[model samples]
Target: MGKLLTLAKEIIFPSRTTCFICGREEIVGEDDLCDACRESIHLCICPPAPLPLDGVSAGLLYTKELHEPMHRFKYRDKVEYAAFFCQYMSIPQDWSIDILCPVPLYYLREMKRTYNQSELLARRISAIYQIPYCRDLLEKTRNTATQTRLNPAQRQRNVQNAFKAAPECKNLSVLLIDDVYTTGATLASCAKELKKQGASKVYALCACKTDN
Candidate 1:
């Protein structure tokens, strides 16, 4: 089964000879990004966490150059992009996380998308670090509006009370996974619910974050 799964990943996410971002047939690195892309995609420097979150970290600073690719990864069924994004998602050494919990989509939205992009990211990171991930630890109870066009205050209102935590989360230090962190309203809301359910700590890790 392991061999089969490996073969399937190779077949589905096939090795890229060119940069996945620019489609340049340059020397792509292990993450499948060429030198130019690797350089242009800036690393996210110590992003601050909002209330209810113990800490937050991100792989890259979300720039205009990344918008289309990130959009495709989340909405266009480019599930394989999770592998590429996971290459940069590093866990901080001091987090002391016990498990990963993905920020979920509402059931109806997930049914339409067929998968939550955050869940895909968390699963890959779990495999890489040998840490367990639990999708059932948190849930999206409301189908909220997209946070893309909203202002920070509006974003906060959009996701407020949208999440619920499971009893199993009690006392566990969790790291929340998502594709991107913008304003952090959504993550903070999720973290708040987790803590209310007795989570010892709730940190967030995203593939990227808005440079703001």
Candidate 2:
């Protein structure tokens, strides 16, 4: 993200185009790449997983393209990068929800980052679908370590008891939001919390994910 753009800036001249991902000076479209490169990126479409806990929805596979913008959107505050969320989103036909929710982050991280990346994605979805945003319906109860650094079993255990839902949300279908999905343990924990809080239904949306 920032690193990509910073490098890109160094090469700027009168008229220059570069692949958004690899920066090959042969980009074809707006912040895009040539056909072979674009197709080679493996922009896969994942069949809707059965919510794993309840109703869920997601857009793109967290392949190479999605990783950078999502990273910049959070770490660099490039809010405009959020466009990539819906720029590639494929709304699930199964999803019909009243409100959108972000998988809550621990307060310390949110304060440190000054924004919740998941909530930012949620707002984009809400705006596009004309749905309501309920950003506060979920809360993080524990600050867990990065899920990727841990194995699958450890990831599951790490996210357990990490999330909770607000008491005010009842009879509501929650649409949980996050930047990416991997093992889904984090989402499962959040779903459990939403169920415990009396949410009639829970759905989720993320910018990208791998392995469907």
Candidate 3:
């Protein structure tokens, strides 16, 4: 009877779900992506080039295999993917950041999406590392155009003055979290505001970075 019940459950809920990237049902592990797709993911080997921010760390190189999963994580309602993605983020031992602050979304845009993807990643990191997560420390003062289509220079221009750091950030070291680091423009702008508000140092941690 137990075996029969288990079989019935799998039939009802479809225990074998397709991989997030390749759409293969023969997933080997509990992760959303199958074993073959997981093995194909190319992690970033070398650290990214220096940005305006003090330091930058990223997990994966933006590749064709990562595109669909990231799209589903950010735009689609695949919030559960945060755990899978967070596995790649590795915080440096020497940084000793005081707080984890996810890049904020404007109120209207956040309301439309129902949650900030970065915040989701930050919360997971906070829980894992026992660091305090401060959502209010930095905020998006204005809703700007998406950085998807912009060139590196234009990306900088688009996000200029877009973030406002709270005074409570004074003297605190911060680690900013984001879903992607395309041109480093968004992170640079955020770091600038944090520093202007008296943040001692700001570092960036991103789940993926474009390999330009």
Task: List CA RMSD, all candidates.
Answer: 6.5, 6.9, 3.6
Lowest summed lDDT over 10 consecutive residues: which window, candidate 2? 43-52
Cα lDDT, model 2, residue 8: 88
143 in model 1: Cα distance from truth in Å?
0.5
TM-score quality measure for candidate 1: 0.90
Which candidate ranks first by lDDT, i.e. highest?
Answer: 1
Number of the top TM-score candidate = 1
lDDT of 2: 0.72
Q: What lDDT tens digits, residue by residue, belong to model 2 across residues 24-142?
A: 67636653656555674544455544444564445666666556656777788876666756666555777668788878778999898888887777788888888888878888887
lDDT of 1 by residue, 141-164 (tens): 988999989999999999999999
Q: What's the lDDT for all of these models?
A: 0.92, 0.72, 0.88
lDDT of 1 at 90: 92
Candidate 1 residue runs with Cα over 4 Å from true position = 1-16
**Candidates 2 and 3, the one with greater TM-score:** 3
Off by over 4 Å in 3: 1-17, 46-51
List TM-score per model, in order: 0.90, 0.80, 0.89
Lowest lDDT sum, 10 consecutive residues, model 3, at 43-52
- After superposition, candidate 2 runs with Cα above 4 Å error: 1-19, 23-37, 47-52
| TM-score quality measure for candidate 3 | 0.89
Error of 1 at 192 (Å): 0.5
